[model samples]
Target chain A: MAAAPAPPLPDFEPAGLLRVRQGFDLAAVDPRSTPGFDGGKDEGERLLAAEDEELSDLQERLFAQSRSGARDAVLLVLQAMDTAGKGGIVRHVIGSVEPQGVHHKAFKAPTAEERSHGFLWRIEKELPGPGMIGVFDRSHYEDVLVQRVRGLTPPAEIEQRYGLINEFEAKIAAGGTRILKVMLHISKQEQKERLQERLDRADKHWKYNPGDVNDRAYWDDYQHAYQIALERTSTDAAPWFVVPADRKWYARIAVQQLLIGVLADIDPQWPVADFDVEREKLRLAAS
Target chain B: MAAAPAPPLPDFEPAGLLRVRQGFDLAAVDPRSTPGFDGGKDEGERLLAAEDEELSDLQERLFAQSRSGARDAVLLVLQAMDTAGKGGIVRHVIGSVEPQGVHHKAFKAPTAEERSHGFLWRIEKELPGPGMIGVFDRSHYEDVLVQRVRGLTPPAEIEQRYGLINEFEAKIAAGGTRILKVMLHISKQEQKERLQERLDRADKHWKYNPGDVNDRAYWDDYQHAYQIALERTSTDAAPWFVVPADRKWYARIAVQQLLIGVLADIDPQWPVADFDVEREKLRLAAS
Candidate 1:
């Protein structure tokens, strides 16, 4: 009998379709397009569900290997506009894995103590340990994005931060950290609808901030800042993927697939036993 | 027509059935018994699944309330011997809720810096924020359990720690934080079986430490130390619940029910909007 042909791989590889390449224009990408994914929302959900067991298994191996002195990890940095569903990605995609292997930090405004140090000081403190995945909900990029848009720091200082971030990420990558930078790209109109929904429901009122409306007024400046930051910081060592996030389900699954792919590449294996297994088994049975 | 009679509540009330009461005897409590819960393994799984939605809703409300200046929070402290399924509870019970709303800290050995300070110093830094649920995988009780049994600390200092723990818990409770302490009680036989299985499986070797066998030799000493710690520290502000953990499913569901009951008691409500609703609706529509 003839050998069976290999099955086709899933069309969820995000590197080619979503990655920010040289001279990439953010304006050219459509926020509603589900690039490289032929599936609709239902298919996206199914694919994501199918990967749950594999994700859990891979994480367990990674954790086990770490205990045996493996130095490998993945850092997923999430940057998005308000109401762009960063929290949803965290809850749906990252939360499905083993919690012990996941380290998450949400960076809010810096304290007086943090401001006393360099911008990268806090970021350095939260890097994931060996054989773990670290998630930054809003990361060092915020120093360039918001600070640039609001003029919180000087123009020269803001420009300096892009170089600092690139260097910082390169150092981390050199230490066996695979950095996946995701920018959840949502249109201005979609943001308005989301904000309106928050206003329409009483339970969601707490999520709505009046300041978001003021921030919305600076949308053009923010977008410009994001464009420049992406251009300056997107490197081979740490690249950015602008995921179309208008469809929340698609965005979630795409991110999940990206993570699964990275982990598959790493291919963490279960460590071999150091002791004589047969002898230990006999001893255990007797004991 | 009269309304139908309300359904009976599930009998897995950890507060009543498992709480370490005055004059509590750990030796008398069977580690194999399911306490008030009459459920089998399948029933326990069903009940845990049923509580997922309610747990998520209550947590969202708590998170929302916190944004509006509500100071209420819940801290679930889990103390268990090795192989008693603390990781299982974290993944199954606590992982079902919003990741953003749940703060988890797994306390391992104290670092040199942490050992330099008082025991409570490291713990204070990891406490749950207002309107969040914090889960402590292993907690300050380790000072009494491991320290006393291993003779790591002086007897006088160990005696003083019980009082210190009570006072620390009381101080936290006074600041709108509700404390729920749970001790997963697994039988010695079950522990032996678990450790044996770990040794028999090559994949599980990373989790097995030869030191665990040495620790097993002091099992009775650890038990005696635990009994004293539970009896001395079980107070109105922070009570300890000793759930039979030989059955992992039952222990998980019991812990879930305990968390749900505490959240139900708090009954966090959504905050009213500070901004004008109708005006924003129109403005959003116009935009």
Candidate 2:
């Protein structure tokens, strides 16, 4: 029998290809595009499932490394508009790791105390400790996006936040925290469908907010704010990836691939035994 | 041929059967017993897998109810000796739900600040918020366990904590948190074998603490301490369940079943739409 040819592999890397560079244009990107993934929904789902063991192993190694006093960690900062699948990414992608390894925060409208402090102050407090995967459902980027679009802050102040955020990210990156910032890009039509579905279903009614539609009135301004934020803060210390969110499967797989890439780069080893193995074996045996 | 008879169900409820009642004897309980589960490792694993969707649904309902202002929540408190598979329960059973809905805390030896406060002070701060399933890998019960075993606290103070814990638990339970405290009962032989395995595997060494074998010297004292803690603090407001954890699969399923039962009792309903669905539909369409 003739030898079977090896199956083709995905030629491009998601982390590098989907990454935002200087002069990145939000308007030029397609919300439904599945960049670098040549798979349909079924194939995408299968590939994601297949990546589970590697993802799990990598996560556990990172966690184990932390126990041995390695100070490396990962922070996944997810920013998106309402109904843009941030929660889906949390559940499907980040959910694959040990819950113990994840520190999740969903930043909401600033509380009185939060508003009293500098924007970066609250953001600094929630950074992941060594060996953790910290997730921010909506993050400090909101200061630049919603604060700019809604006139919540002065134009100068909002403009200043971009530099502040870059400095803050650089500090953390230098401190051994690998930052992955993702913008889940969904089209306006997709948002309408999602919001409509939420309104239609009694079970999903709790997730719908009247303010979300009100915010939709300023969607263009928010997009402009995002464009500015992306252009200013996509730095070498922490770059952003714009994952098209119209296809949930593609978005999830893309995020998973990004995480896998970052973890592989960290390449945490299982810490070598700090105690004498032979003596400990005898001690444990006697115990 | 006659139709086959329906497969028999496990006659007892693990939650009810394993509950630590007054006068419960810790020494008499077999660590290897399967309790209410009538299955071997493979069947137990399969059954646990089968319960995932139901567990996921129940958890989502609890989370949805929270968003709609329901105060209900669950706090799963796990207490065990070394290598008792507490982490396994977290990874297998509790890990089935959306990560956003779970708040996990693994209590370590008290820091200087923690020691300065009352033992229950730190515990109170980490309780699950509305709609969350909070997990404490080791809990306030430790104040009674290791503290008692090692004489870390005065006998009078240790004796006093049981009452304080009951009062604290009653307060929370009254405030809409369902508490499920589980003690993973593993035999000394099992612990020895598990410790030996950890010592043998380089990848597992990070998890092995030298203090673990030292703690093993007082294994009997720890059991006695657990017995006292169970007898005094396992009240109607917050009961304890002694799970035979020699079989990791059984321990996970028991905890999973306990969670399912508690959530079923809470019986969180999907909140009714607060706004006019038709009106919102039109608004969303216009947006």
Candidate 3:
């Protein structure tokens, strides 16, 4: 009999395709393709459901380890255009785990006090403690993205932030935080559809912002800013993952998988009992 | 034929049974009773499941309103003895909603810097922004509860904190935050059972702090402190609710109901579109 045909290889590994490697070009990555995930939408949903239990378990262990004096954590930084499904990723992926272990900060327009200090001042206060899973929805990158695109900051200062961000992330990584930066890449066409959907539904009206249209006018500038940000800040300590976000399901699953991969690498274990277990058991039983 | 007798009213409406009223006595509340809720453990679980959709919807509306320039927000202050299920409330009740709208702060022992400032200074910084639900898993009340119980602060100063807390809460309440202060009341027997459970399970050993046992020795003192805190600070602006927390399911549902009630009261409305919808539709279609 002829030898059986070789088993087919799985589609793409999202970690590799999404990661910002040297000379990575943002324009080259298609926002609609599910690069590493071969499965269709149904498959992605199924995979996300399957990973829920593991994610919960890993998060609990990480929290337990932190309570036992471990200084390791995971920080997920999410940057995306309006209606690019940042909220969906937060709700579907991070929402699966215990809330006790997750720290989420949605950075909005800076306050007067925040503007007076260095951009990272407020951010440093929100870093996850040991054993935490921190999610930053539009983080320090905003200083470079919007400020650069809109000409709100001096060019020299904007350039300085890229270096500052890299050094800051490197210092935190050295302190045991596994940083995963994700940019949800949605096509302009997809964005128009989403924006239209927000307008079409009365219930979604509150989420619609007239300013978003103004921002859309500067789309090219924003994209160029993102390209420079990705090139400058995707260091070894904190790598950026350009997630193809046109399909909400694929983006959610890919982000979940990325988090799971980092957590598995950390492999937090439950701490051993500090007191004598047998003695405590006997004492408790007697009591 | 005689008409069937009407069903009896449920004794404990968690919203009413748990809310602090004038001359409230913490000692009178039974930690094990499911007040106003005629549900057993299974019923509590089912009710919680039933409320999940509404809770999520309310939170989303609150978040949407906040984003659309509504200043209204809800702040849930969780104060409990060790293992009283503060974490469980966060996970089961608040966790069901979109994480983007929930701000959770787990206040640990104060650092040297925090000690240098007034207690509320640190707390003021963490207050939920407009349109967010902030959960304090142990809050400024700690300054009174632990500090008073342990005599960490002078008696006169501890006495002064209640007035300061009320003033601070009033200031914020006037600014649009609706505060719900919940005190999880568990029986001494229940605490012992919980503490013993931690000691028995190796996986839970990390949560077993020997200091918790030491704290147990001061249970009566802590109760006395809580009684005073509840009596003094349970104002109309920011009332305290003492939920019988021995039943984890009941406490979680009750807290959820409390939050739902507040959001319902606020009645956040969807903002009208600032831009001309018809024009945007034509513009997007043409684009």
TM agreement with the true structure for every prediction: 0.93, 0.96, 0.87
Any runs in candidate 2 off by more than 4 Å, and if so which?
Answer: A1-12, B1-12
- lDDT head-to-head 1 vs 2, winner: 2
The best candidate by TM-score is 2
What DockQ values do the models have? 0.35, 0.52, 0.30
Name the lDDT of candidate 1. 0.88
iRMSD in angstroms, per model: 10.0, 6.7, 11.2
Provide the TM-score of the second chain in candidate 2: 0.96
> Per-residue alpha-carbon lDDT of model 2 for B1-287, expressed as tens digits?
45555454443358889999977999999999999777687778777888889899999999999877999999999999999998888888988798889999999999999999999999999999999999999999999999999999999999888889999999999999999999999999999889888887888899898999999999999999999999998889999999999989889888889899999999999988788888888888888
> Each prediction's Cα lDDT score?
0.88, 0.90, 0.89
Q: Which ranges in model 3 have alpha carbons more than 4 Å from their true place?
A: A1-13, A22-25, A109-126, A147-168, A224-228, A231-233, A278-287, B1-13, B67-69, B113-119, B154-157
Worst-scoring 10-residue span by lDDT in model 2 chain A: A3-12
Tell me each candidate's RMSD, in Å, in order. 4.8, 3.3, 6.1
What are the per-residue Cα lDDT tens digits for candidate 1 across B1-287? 55555444465666688889898999888888888887688778878888888888999998889888999999999998899999999999888888888888999999999999999999999999998999999989999999999899999999999999999999999999999999999888898899898987778988877666667778889899999999999999999999889999989998998888889989999999988988877766665
In candidate 1, residue A70 scores what lDDT?
86
Native-to-model Cα distance after best TM-score fit, residue A53 in candidate 3, in Å:
2.5
Quote the lDDT for B56 in model 1.
87
Ranking by lDDT: 2, 3, 1
